[model samples]
Target chain A: MSATSPSRSEQVPLAESAPREARESAAPAWRRSPPRWHGVAEALIKTTALVAIVAIVLIFVFIAAETLPLFTSHEVRAEVTPSTMAWKQTWGEAAARWSWQPASEIPKYSIAPLIIGSLKITVVAVLVGAPLGILAAIFTSQVAPRWLREILKPTIELLAGIPSVVIGVFALLVMATWTHRLFGLEHRLNAVVAGCALSLTIIPLVFTLAEDALSSVPKSFADASLALGASKMHTVLHVMVPAALPGIAAGVVLGFGRALGETMIVVMASGNAALVSWSLGVSTRTITATIAQEMAEVVHGSPHYVVLFALGAVLLLFAFATNVLAMRIVESFRRKRGGS
Target chain B: MATIEPSQRSPGGEPRAAVLTAAPSPKLEVRGLDVFYRGEKGGETHALQDVTVDVFPREVLALIGPSGCGKSTFLRVLNRMNDTIPGARVAGKVLLEGEDILAKDYDVVTLRRRVGMVFQRPQPFPKSIFDNVAYGLRAHGLADKREITRRVEQALGRAALWDEVKDRLDAAALGLSGGQAQRLCIARALAVEPEVLLLDEPTSAPDPIATAKLEELIAELKADLTIVIVTHSMQQAARVSQRTAFFYMGRLIEVGATKQMFTRPRETRTEDYITGRFG
Candidate 1:
């Protein structure tokens, strides 16, 4: 460093004696002026974000507007009132009051069977998906070798890249026969098969979110645990898992919402039966499936069309609620961490 | 080396018969330890080069050095914590009571239990204060609730933290002040009843008052437990340790009694560093 200083000093006067114009021209032109595209890029990104938020709000407004006729229009109300949809109707003494035969002569519209079916399939999906995803995430983040994790993480996430329709077709054709042979189910396509297939879709979503959370836990925490003589398994299970609980919970809630609103998978594999039975082997139809199956064929302004929109409105509200709840949980957990 | 009388060393501390003998057998005998880390540039960075030190029983041995001088690395060598780093390589022997802890088949879990560590930053588990102290006990299969509670209180008391945190044992450990949290970490390590405790710049994160409190705790703790502390502060080494080791560029420059090393350091580099000539 010292040896170069004399040579550097010897050249300073010669370089500085050059004209100011020459020095100015020597530097690159782009370095002298700010690029014009930077501001435009920022504005584009901001507008895109704003447009996304506004579009979501607009969609909810449109769906809610469509459901408004159920309360206001007499023609739509004659077939399905909010009260009639929720409560038992007197179709006949023999006919089931809590049925959903929308195309029958009486066109019964009790949503109980659809609600029960949605709950049953969603519950099954969450039960199967949450643990599998969480455990897989734990393995990838905490236990798996680096090479194995490199292979496993992308492969598991590849499940998400597969179109839900393809998964539905697989369930409808291949899984239907497998379930019938393995469990001897009464229906070849039942709630269990559809729920299991639905779980396959959520596993990747939950695993990605959960693995990110687990990986983000500070290394210091693990160091402290291990330095206390705790085994690797004990350190991960006790310390890392609890630290990442909020994120894991958010993943599970998002998976639940996805299962609730999923259309193609449930529609193709659930046998389209609106049964209120608690049996997993029986066929069922979720509200999402109901809307998807009926929306195209129904008359645009008919009671059935409005009823389907109302179910859509309900599904939309649930998705919104689940998102808000997950956000709240994550926010509260972050605040707690920051405060402590 | 000057041999101070045992009575003058620590008035009411643990017996120095094991430490003050003519040729004292080291509680931790590290011989020619070398650590190499694989750098991002695909080169082997020699972190510690042919370093050897002896930590006698019931003594506070302070390792003082500048940043990246291998003091912290030497401390981690006691418990084999360097094994966690992916590209870290260790050579030479770290013998604990004549048994080579660097052996291929050495059980790191057992080694860590016998030689506990407190990090530079206080990292309490995301658990209640009581649970933080009880983590090791439970990990090692001490299942009785009353026994855990009793041991937790005892360990906290040893760390000089029980009186402050006793009433709110259920409160999150992270809620404590930096000093209290560090003491809580000490308590957590103490709960395991390790013979040697390794502190790697433990006072660097806390405030001056906290540093003083920790220094005082070290004085009290050395009554029974052997301590190896790595610190950047020369004054802290002079105050808290019985013997001080000065390290520079991953080499042990000097090791002697704190009084002698600080007042009349034999090595020019050690004297220059202590006098703030260069880090």
Candidate 2:
């Protein structure tokens, strides 16, 4: 049998190879190569990925290019220098240290009031929003039953889909009257009203992110805490909350960034007054509102337009920094807990 | 052999032929216990059947079984950890020194304080080592800082981890090695000084050396606390436990002195399981 089969293997390759070579030569050129759309598809996807980065870079360049005129042009510089934008200048009779009157005969371009107004409103928004968001997250993750959580989560997230203009309208039309009557405030639409309305946007963002953070904490942590005789309250507050703190901080930071640059709500409800005062009841104007209001009427290529672009640049940097800070908080927490 | 002598000092060392010998009143007496878990689609899983057993005072009772045989489920029942599950239902009586812990009006906080548990994997809080141990004590309302510090040290000492971590108690507990974190979890449970400590396959995740260390720690710990351990390895149960209970298909097949059960298992299922015939 071995002797008979010794040449059998030699005949099989010749038989198989003759038709294989024929089929190979007979096949179309396109069959031998990959599909045509494969390369095109990959290139399209690659370009799509770069779109976000390219758009961000282009926006930065545009803002930077427009702002550069403030520093370089003598005409723009005469109207407002960097020093004039930051420092107080005495105008004739009144010794005003920080005024933002850009339309006067001798213009005062101090940005201190804008900065202070931004900080005050952002602080109020965060103070009102962060606690409510964080507490709702805790209730959803720790205390709510499964069916209730299923309903509560989506309903809260839906709050984010509400347009900022609608919230501003609600604040301007409804809440302004209530706040005015309750607090006996001089202005119906003020920083506090704008801030409270702005919190409507912050709540959903913070709630979604913080809830994710808290729920992602391993079930074993809660199990261990409960097994150790901790009350349900103690387990949630002491173990689960602390475990998710970094993520919660990141959420709050991102919320702060959102509140900083939001324009529609602030512009509509804040009454667009540029006075810098400590009282929460007084009408205020934010940097975002200033750019939204003045960028249309201010002469193109004027110092006022250049200053608005500078504010845009500042906001871009701030948003970038907060994102980086949030990413670092999450990353460092992961690295520290990498042993587990 | 010298290390093995300590485990033999328990009642399992005696030649008591009967499974339930006349002993002191049980620390925990479970009767007609059944557990049901509701599935997402409205189905029911009978996790544990009508099973009854007794955990004597200061005895290391090891529960051995294959995967999903309700050994871990039974361990969780001791401290009512199953209450955390979404649709878990429990029936029958679990008496801790004569009072029924499963009663409708029973205070779970007090019940859990008397019965602590450690999980299969080490679950130290994402906090400093000192705070991890001090967490339970503080929850029980021990406000004095010195008392908390003293109890934390004692618990860590009992878990054989105080010396390794004394210098850096401020270091994050998550930064510890696998075995150290496991011991830290044990110390966290011990800080409350529960009368019963339930360990659910505590050595399954660690290496052999860490497993040996944990087994040794268990033998030393049984002197003061009543321990109920669930394990998959027959050798682990033989090494550390006084009495061994074999579970199969959610039923307690046999439970007896550790030496007798391994050498001469009475039931055919117990014999098949111990001899590795089939899971």
Candidate 3:
């Protein structure tokens, strides 16, 4: 290189010229030039994103301000009144009990059963959805033929656009009867039914994401494995699968979040019996279902309405946590790749 | 070489395996090998045609030609990597260890294992150095964990990388210097223990020093493994290979011992190519 080129110091100065160019480009904005409409348009293209974020923050501030009064004024509880049925007035009241019911002019709030029911359905949904969806992704990415994969992928993703109410209807009419007949389930709107219906929604989400992850795996790794005399399946199982773990985890978490927030399917199919039972065949209710069912009946400014908002807060926190965890997993994977 | 999966029936819907042998009957034998692509224009475009060559064991054969000469395409035929290409077809025969690789009765998985390939770029797995070396072993289930660890050490040592990376086995492979990454790739191939290693311009992506180091490593590897190196750089072929074959317009112009082919040419095209004339 020295024989055919200038001295290394000359090259160093040439490199230094780059930083000088950067400085030249960094002059103060006002002195550079007055902006035109197109320039403003271009800047708007970038700032549109910033504006959207500010909009979101404004909405969040509004929600927080409106919701703050309830938390500050009173511990959430049912107000005893001259009535015939029991009902919980606030989420804080509901949260403090193991079971909730509004009966015969008396309103009592207990949300433990609803919380437990939500946990049951989400757990069941995740357990069934994650593995099946990931496995679908693995087969599509690693094993399926190119033409078949192209056709199958979009068809699977089409599930995402299906109306949630249709899925619920399908679950309620067809699947519920099948479950009751096959397994002799006592409750048609059981956790099992909700989980299966939710799994349908979850599959497409996880598959698209997980397939992308698996597809991004370097071909060299596959070649190296195959050259090692490993069977194609073996290669997929041992190398490709593990390498795509972060992506698979991301897909699963995203799927879980969608399932947790799902309302129509759970509302219609889940028995809405706040009774918490570990058996999948038994009746259950998710937080989403509880909110959906009670939202209409609760007075607009009542503590019960505020309690529902609190539930919304809880659900949002869960979804946010899942997304953050997935981001961390992906970030760690990228960092490891970078360090290597 | 690592042992091939014991021949077993694939559950319906998968292509059957092709038998691969690495006893070095002709390190590679080709007769009337042709590749064609069905273009969107609905016409067939031949990539390689009527190609024929016999590579001897323990010898380095270089394929040099103009761009799109199908030199790399023919090189990939050694392991049937072309099989992955859609609408790409290989007619005629490629014989390894006196067996017909194109025959439907053959096992492709087993065949690929016998004929390993290194791509033009050094693409290491997104894994730690130790895991990268261990990947082949684990994927094939060729050995237990204890044994795999041993082979990882041995393969890295053979690639001359153990010293630099011994203390940092857990370092990601992507972090390695260019030379190290290429060697790591070579180590991965070595871990697989293929009898034949097909390299498609192994050092093309590296610096001069790294390229030289790779040349040295190839010299060492050729002592034990049959190497078919495809290089566009004539200097590289002159320095590293035992035999040289020039390819032009998807055809093999000549094949002879490297020194004789370079110094004493039989084909005019080969002579022109080596002397820096039109391909």
For model 3, the superposed segments whose C-alpha errors exceed 4 Å read A1-37, A74-97, A102-104, A336-340, B1-25
DockQ of each: 0.47, 0.51, 0.40
Stretches of model 2 off by over 4 angstroms after superposition = A1-42, A324-340, B1-20
True contacts kept of each: 0.64, 0.80, 0.61
RMSD of 3: 8.4
Ranking by DockQ: 2, 1, 3
**Prediction 1 TM-score vs. true:** 0.89
lDDT of 3 by residue, B1-279 (tens): 121221331321112111112333456667667888778778988888777666667778788888898999998778877766667887877778768888878887777767878887777777788888887677665668788888889999888888989999998888998889888888887887888989998888749988887898889988888999999899999998877778888776777767888888878888888898875
For model 1 the local lDDT of residue B61 reads: 94
Worst 10-residue lDDT window for candidate 1 chain A reads: A25-34
Q: Which of 1 and 3 is ahead in DockQ?
A: 1
Give the lDDT ranking, best first: 1, 2, 3
lDDT score at residue A337, model 2, on the 0-100 scale: 51
Q: Which candidate, 1 or 3, would have the higher TM-score against the true structure?
A: 1
User: Residue B237 lDDT in model 2?
Assistant: 94
Best by DockQ: 2
lDDT of each: 0.88, 0.87, 0.77
